[model samples]
Target: MEFGVFATMAEALDAANKAQKDLVNNYSLEQRDQMISNVRKEFEKINDELSNFEFEETKFGRVEDKIDKNLGGILNTPGTEVIKTRAFATDKGLTIEYSAPYGVVGAVTPSTNPSLTVIGNGISNLAAGNSVVFNAHPFAEKSSSIAVKTFNKAVVDAGGPNNLVTMSANPSLATLQEILESPYVKLLVGTGGPAMVKTLMASGKKVIAAGAGNPPTIVDETADVERAANELYLSTGYDNTLMCTTEKEIFVSNQVLDRFTNAFVESGARLLSEEEANKVRDLIFVELESGEKVVNKDYIGRDASKILSDAGVDVEGDPRVAIFITDKDDLFVQKEQLLPIIPIVPTPNFESAMEWAIEAENNNNHSASIWSKDVYRVTEFGRRINTSIYVQNGGTSAAFGVDGTGKDSPTIATPTGEGITDASTFTRRRLFAMANGGNYIL
Candidate 1:
């Protein structure tokens, strides 16, 4: 029977539970590795097609960027290698400690990263010997269903169980709640906004939640102005700035603000006038009944040029990013605008820049970056921000393993303190002891 797609969450969870049992009882570690390898290879073969499908379905983010993200996540995600076993031998007894799966993991993926999240989570969870039941965002159900089906096919091709990865044919908030409260789900992993994270945290299960972030980027006077501008534009403008790691606000040293902004314009960034900036801001944010300004859902992840045009600005060619000078107090500077529009704040010194950046980060502690030549300033900024992912003199993409040292991960669990989760993150350490085994030489 086909187990990848089911009519209800209960069926998906049941299939996942049975599949996890099969994985632990019948499959060897080497066989699990084979399954992971098959998944990576299968995803690489169809990454471009899946990326294009997600873009067409959700109408969010750039297609090329989606391809890059899905490819990197599939290829670079650490698999069974991260699952380690340790042995302690003594004269009296021998003890073995190793990582064990959490059984069926219920995953809640965001619309912004539909298939990428499902595929990455599947690889990690399956590598750790667990099965998965996915509750994809409603806006991305069809694309995410394809991902679930792909994982099941790849695993089966490698002689793995058929229901290793499963999901509901139709996903919704109701199904998500069912997964959260289901007794069969041993662990929960979710990636989305604060509300989603909060719901998972309250589910009374072991949870790994990747929440919202308003990452800040700082440019100090000691930095390379031109290089900083180019890097900032590339990162903040990437995929229409959909990644949670993307720089939402920028703090630049006043001594080189003009040069930095000018260089950014030269690098295909659209420099908006104060009037145009205000118009764009008004277009993207709305004041709530509580008098609090929040980002408008309609504008999230829209192209920079399209946003400018919608705001009545006479946009030219194709601007990769839109920029404007703004005070630290501006609503746009404080909020997380997933669009390519960026607000640059000028600061008097390195210390003030760091302070303002931390303040604007709002204690999310998700991701932050600094471009500075001075090691002392870099160190200080890193200590002050206390973000989960910190980049020094580089763009935020580096933190996502795009031409950098970090590994690719669709779920960055900042709130739960598991940064860039892998196979090990989904497992629990288990111990086995043998009395008087005489395994130790000493």
Candidate 2:
């Protein structure tokens, strides 16, 4: 099996399959845990350098946010610890549950989160006793390669087999399709956009996919305006809004619109006039001949200065957040603007705000948030939104368990209804039966 570089998808598949046979398929629980720990250490050792490389290679995201994302994948992403077994007993038989692996896994990662996604998915896949073959994004090929090589080395250094994680040198649609068609690749794990997820699902293999989102946030009259503003600014401003869970739009109840606005402005945020907002919008989103507006990828994860400079505005120093006003029907509110730009909309009441926020979420069911102290209103909002992840009076980072508060997951499978993915998401349930056993719960 190859060690560091793979020239083609076939090589990646072959190496990963060999690793699965030599290490993953036969690893004991203790051995798997040791390897997982080693991977985490290796990640931390190179996280700072790797994060900088990720930013340099992809030209997206803030180095600070990438560092945090790398650590989140290590500390928060669930491993074998989340894997559980269930048992039941009847008069005639006893049944025990086991989390069975999917053999070799084919993972397709995005440029936005190259190393982060690889490590997060690698931890879970290894914990589930499956070797991984990666199809890294072309723009992030170098960073992804470094991460994969370090990860594989970590496993081997911990007395694990070679090719525990393998990837090709350059990634393309052809290679991704090739890996998906490979017989050794038993399952697919995708962390990317809609088109990539669609392709993986259509491959006739079982898939755990995490896709796009235009997350929405609401500020009600009962909320603490300052806290809300700070949290919102911190999230969207982080890494120039590269996170899928970053707040794309905000809906504030008209009752506290003035208060929210003042607080939002005090939090190092600069609001553009209606005319300026139009200019910024035009600069951020380009209109096609087909009448559809799309985001300019060049500015997708760029900083505030770059985006604002393009909008014909000059700033003294680096500002944290750049916000503008937009109506519900505005293009900024309709589509996802994956930059430090956030759209604020005014709603008449709590109900209207909730409706507007939910509508802005676009049914991706990925993530949403609200700022409110009212217990009843919070409960109502949570129930109505029913999103995969709902942050209450907190930033979008809460969805990733950033401070050890919420659930940690790499694959937030919204369509499959497995909200926050973990080691359990990668495995199937198997039953072990004993003929003469006892029924306890019954």
Over 4 Å off, model 1: 1-3, 89-92, 435-438
**Ten-residue segment with the worst summed lDDT in candidate 1?**
433-442
User: Candidate 1's residue-wise lDDT over 1-442, tens digit each?
Assistant: 6748999888898989989999999999899899989998998999999999999999998888888878988898888898999998878878999899989999998999989888888999888999989998889998988898888999999999998888888888889888988888999999888888888989889889898899999998888999999888888888999999999999999999999999999999999999999899889989999998899988888888889898999999988799999999888778887889999999998878988899899999899998889999889889989999999888887977765787888999999999889999999989888887556666
Clash number by candidate, in order: 0, 0
TM-score of each: 0.97, 0.96
